[model samples]
Target: MGIFDALNTSVGGLQAQSFALQNISGNIANASTVGYKGIGTSFEDLVPAAAATNRQNSAGVTAHSQATITTKGTVSRSSVSTNMAIVGDGFFNVQKPVGITDNIPVFNGVTNYTRRGDFQLNANGNLVNGAGYYLLGVTVDPKTGNPTGNVPKVLQFQNNFIPAQATTSINYAANLPTKPATVASTTATAGGLKAYGGLDPSDFSAGFNPLVIGTPAPPFTDATTSGSTVNNKQATQISGATLLSGAASTDSIITNFAAGDTITVNGTPITFVASGAVGNQLNVTDSVSTMLAKIDSITGATTASSVTNGIITLHTGTASNLTISSSNATAFAALGFASPTTQARGGGGTVGAGVVIGNDIKVFTNESISGGAVTAYDATGTPVNLQLRWAKVDSSSLGSPHVDTWNLFYQANSSATGTQTAWINAGTNFRFSASGALTSPSGSSISLPGVTVDGQSLGTQTFNFGSGGLTQYASTGGTATINNIFQNGYAAGQLQSIAVNNSGLVVGTFSNGQNLNLAAVSLSHFNGTNYLKALDGGAYAATDESGVAIAGATGTINGSALEGSNTDIADEFTKLIVTQQAYSANTKVITTANSMVQDLLNVLR
Candidate 1:
């Protein structure tokens, strides 16, 4: 070989060794970097021309090329809820802010893809990297748990809240006890019968005439006069004709005996008798008065008696007067009077006669009373108890017939006292005012319109959380605003589970009694993932030949685990010795070529 040829060969060897050293340096630099792939060098042959019978060319050693970078890196897990790594072929998409004027782009926008999983929220409340670069993915509806679209969504805390109120109206029933009867006088009779006092002079003098004697007739001789009693000693015989004679009887005289005469008749003591014939009659003065004397002893009446000439008078207790009238002689006979001269009739008929009966008896029916008021009772006549429940709704969800949000406020029981008052403020929280006039905070207020309770719809309700902070939404076109007053009102929550799908959807579960779509992580895959350029800190960037990142997940490229570097110390040392030997051999070739050139010069000398 010519000296120049030998020199070129040695230079090629120097270049190849230098290239291998550079690759080794790179590998050592990224030995600890996550997802780091080491690089290696390759050598190619150079061609030279030689003339012969049939001219042909031969190949010789040429320069080295740093060709492929093997992606033989180890995968270690941090086990963090947010920590993620692509095991196979994909990359996590990220977007670094271009400037102050540009907002973070979404998935479809200009985004840089990486494999680094370290993520956190930035000061602007966006989930980002430590460099403040925003992530990209498909956003989802919080309530429906479904994808909205491929857009970048920021995760944040929710703060729209208010209070609720109660209800009114009540009913009842009951029974009442019956009343007893009362008694007044013991003297009151059962069937009513009374006694009369006939001895009363007032009774006799009321309307009767006085008794008198009649004139004597012929065939009768007078035996005595008013002042003298002697006669001619002749006994005059009085005949029936004298007794029957109208003129002698016209005076109604009981003349058989004179005044002050006495006789025992019908077991009663009498004093006068007629004087003309054998059938002489007696005239009893005030005969009814005498009968009244006997009745007075049996009843509660007072009696008195007086005598004048041939007449005796009697008086009774003050009531009405009794009179004996001549027209009532027949009635006198009905009273067991034998002679008109013995008994007399009265005008007032009788004294102290009618009756009186039954006293003090109860008269109406019973009625029911309850709850300090009157109300209709049940079939068994018992008072009934009542119960009530009150709840609020989301105004927007009301017209939809499906209740998305509801909060219960008050419930009525038997221990409840008075009227339940519900305060519905236009832009404040709900307040419940009880019968005792006490007010208290209630449950969460619903912002949705057209909410209903027990099938009754409420158009919309206004409520407030704190001072001057209000939420007003109607079933119509009302706007709901949650102010800073309620910003501090948050229900407690915690991280539960995490899940990811091929679409790069990230769902986080919470211990706050809810399952929420917390966030969606960015993801991408390259057509030539093997050719992707690795940067520091376990990250990768796309290049022209990496072929426009077709976004995908880990398993898409196949379930192949990335094996760690085969850069064993022994193997690298042996390779280093081999490269040094080749370098030394190339230098020897140059030395030998110089020696040959020296020999040629000696020959020319």
Candidate 2:
């Protein structure tokens, strides 16, 4: 052994302590750094292979620098949504620009993983962390909301408008009153108000129900005829009369009639009953003629009625003193009477149709089942309000419940491309089950054929009324009420915001009410993370000792949060004290060794 072996040993100790102190400094310096892995130093004794044969037993000490990569940092809340932390062992795949190649961000195809998660959208709309590395992940298909492939790439968000999607399906859920609204039996036909089955004199609107306009095999005549059979174009007697807007029922006067209904003509009470009676109490099924007779039987009223082309016209002998009012709330509407309107009395005859009428006919809209209205979008992203009205074509009394039918009519602006107000038949029968549920023509979904709203031709749209979505239940006032409705269509939209989910998905939300999966964050797991090579930023490169990077998403992602440095300030300070004391002891050992060497020289002299 050399006489200065003690000095060499002490020098080695000094170097080892210095290296440990360096690690302590680094650990303490990065305590607040996000996703920072603390570095630790290990000491080892250096012994030559021939140390047992050599005189010198101990050689020196050396430092082994290693990263505490396996240690998990404290995950804390963050204001940024893109900031994310992994609870288990994993690294975020990131790409850094090594240089520009052909004006592209060249990375030399080097794959790097990082723990730093201070990610933000850069000027180019790329997610770049604080370390100037772009985050990479797998892309996804918007239509299916599924990941396209496992291949990784830098995620870029474009600010262009999200293309408009035409409405393909509509989900409608509703509860329909089993019966129509209640009506009165003894209703006095007043002026302005028209009867439920009355014909319209002025018909400016097109798109009336085909059944109403087509010729009835047997020409429909008086008020007893079904209103659904009367069309303005019909060559029959009602050919000139505009079809009434409402469902056809036995009460042609009113679909639903209740007892105790009465009519007051110039202050005369004409109540209804179930049997033969006059002035005392009228029969519930009494016709307009019976009502006029009963009124004539009274001294206060002198009533006259004419039923032509399905319209019931009524007037009093003394028009000046005649005022027909309902004793019940529904009686007036049942009689189809309103404020006295100036019915332009045509001289003695009617129009070319020869339909007898005390006064000219009126124009009216048809009755509808009212499936409710919804805003539909066109191919070009134009929006329009579509009004739907459904009217009963076949009633349960005609045949089996399953055979009962209804017609759907849609109205929008006919003049404007996106605006339609004229009703057009949907050309589909809404059939029902014996139980009163919409069962056929397929209960699963109703396919409305091609129809133009505004000027845009929207393709066939499917309506999923839900399982048993339509139901018919009897009530005093049977009214159609839509409970729920939704459509899968949207207009053009711009990027609104971005969010990260626990599944490590970077989702971008658009103003058009769409949350699209833009990319999935990539996680790489390593077997020997400590052996990974450190890079300029807070990233690590793969090494043979580290093993191949395993694509891992098993780690729980804490979004809107960051992982604090694993370095503990208190622990680092303790290590710093220990390192400082050890350094001092090494210096003292060197000084004492020097003194001993001097004494030996003195003894030799």
Candidate 2, superposed: residue stretches over 4 Å from native: 47-59, 100-104, 141-150, 173-372, 388-444, 465-484, 494-499, 509-514, 556-558
lDDT of 2 by residue, 363-470 (tens): 213333456888877876677676665555455644344255655556544342211234555556666666887766664676776756666777788878767777
Over 1-605, each residue of candidate 1 has an lDDT whose tens digit, in order, gives 55767677677777777777676666666555444455666778776765674654433464443423334345544534444555565666776654553443344345666554555544444555544446566666554557676654344322311112111111211111111011211222332110110011112122221111111111111111011111211123222111211232332222223334443322334333333212222334324333334433322235343222323333323332222222233333333222323222223332311100011001000000011211211223222222111112111222344222212222112222222212111222232221211122343333323323223333342322333222222322111122222111113345445544333446555553444564566457766765666554445567887778775555331112222333445555666777778778877877887888899889977
- Locate the minimum summed-lDDT window of 10 residues in model 2: 354-363
Lowest summed-lDDT stretch of 10 residues in model 1?
360-369
Best by lDDT: 2
TM-score of decoy 1: 0.39
- How far residue 175's Cα lies from its native spot in candidate 2, in Å, is 5.4
- TM-score for each prediction? 0.39, 0.61
